[model samples]
Target: MTDWWLWMYVAAMAGGVALFTRWRADPRGVPLSEYRVAIAIPFWSGLWYLVMALGGGRAEVAGHTVYWARYADWVVTAPLLLVALMLTGTHSLPGRRWRLMTALVGANVVMILSGLVADLTTDGTARYTLYAIGVLALLVVYGLVWGPLRAHARRQPAGIAAVYTEAALLLSVLWAGYPVFWILGPSGVGLLGSTTTSVLLVGLSILSKVGWSIVDLGRLRALSDRGHLTVV
Candidate 1:
């Protein structure tokens, strides 16, 4: 695999770990646990898209791979990871986590349908436009729904909401940039810009994971000490 593919794999694994850690720490039990699993869906899907984009090469699929087309899917799919992360954290949809999940599923379905149509129709401009629409849909969902929910949740202590919200917002910004780059730039420039943006996002993801891990460790230590003191 290319260096880009390797980096993508690393980013996915790191994000998965960060997400799992937060899920485990969630004291609310099943509501949050289910949310965690929901969050994993997009992370895993995005990872698959990343691998296909970077490593699938010119392999034929149904007579034509549409290599660049698959990358457009990757761009659309990547934002879902942030959305999932936002939902899993304290920023759950007020009385509507399931509703948000449904919306996410619907958004993904539209994206897939549009992608297939674009692929079969072999309309490059339409494909790009459809992918751009998908990206916009995700942004609106995150900003209007998930972001507000998270902001409300952050009123509590433990800093979980704040950390996760910051991470998700950072990721959302990165994901949103890809389509903007494609829409505004010259040929080949989008690829360069997208790849550069991915690199930065991946780097920030690693740091975010590290921070979360550290915080989790501190909490674990405090709990352990509390238990020991009680025994003493």
Candidate 2:
């Protein structure tokens, strides 16, 4: 009923619709793996939005009660999905590498669980541990999967290069933005801290995805110019 709750619901519905549209469109013309990962974007985004909306319905914090689920979804779940999409989307990656992809997804699952645990735990230490695990999982994803994919993208066609570059930039933004927001934002008791952190993270995550879409569009334009593909 509150403004924060209203924002959360709206964000969730919007994200869900966007993701569904993306899935239905399937514009990439890539493998199933890529589609699988891509489909997750909206679902997770919506879920986080819903969670925050419900959890902080009438809660107040630091002069406001902005829904923070958007941040959490963006920072934690969205990144995991993005990384998965990138890895699977890479032209150079072999099918056998899917095992690694699966592992990465599993790590993301853990991160999601960690977040939930943090939310549920009353003890400060336990919550922090869960948060730490979520952070570490993301780090591993960057170090192991995203790192190699970036290198491969650099060597691929300009279109691929553009996509990967955009992805990299998005990841970098997410990596940098989250901690800064958390450290500087208002601190309060109960759901406020985690929710706020989540909202900030989600904003960054959306920014990164938008960046990728822009880069991909540019790459398409370049490719069209080269006469490799006809402009639609």
Best by TM-score, which number?
Answer: 2
- C-alpha lDDT of all candidate models, in order: 0.47, 0.53
User: Distance from true position, residue 202, model 1, in Å?
Assistant: 8.0
lDDT of 2 by residue, 126-160 (tens): 76677778778767766654566566666666665
Off by over 4 Å in 1: 1-96, 108-121, 146-148, 151-155, 181-232
Q: Clashing residue pairs in candidate 2, if any?
A: 71-198, 71-199, 71-202, 72-198, 74-202
Q: Give me the runs in candidate 2 sitting further than 4 Å from their true place.
A: 1-40, 47-80, 87-89, 92-96, 179-202, 208-232
TM-score of 1: 0.50
Error in Å for residue 135 of model 2: 2.1
TM-score of each: 0.50, 0.61
| lDDT (tens digit, per residue) of candidate 1 on 114-209 | 544544544567767776666666656566445555655565344445545555565555445544543443222234443454455345444333
Q: Model 1, 28: alpha-carbon shift in Å?
A: 13
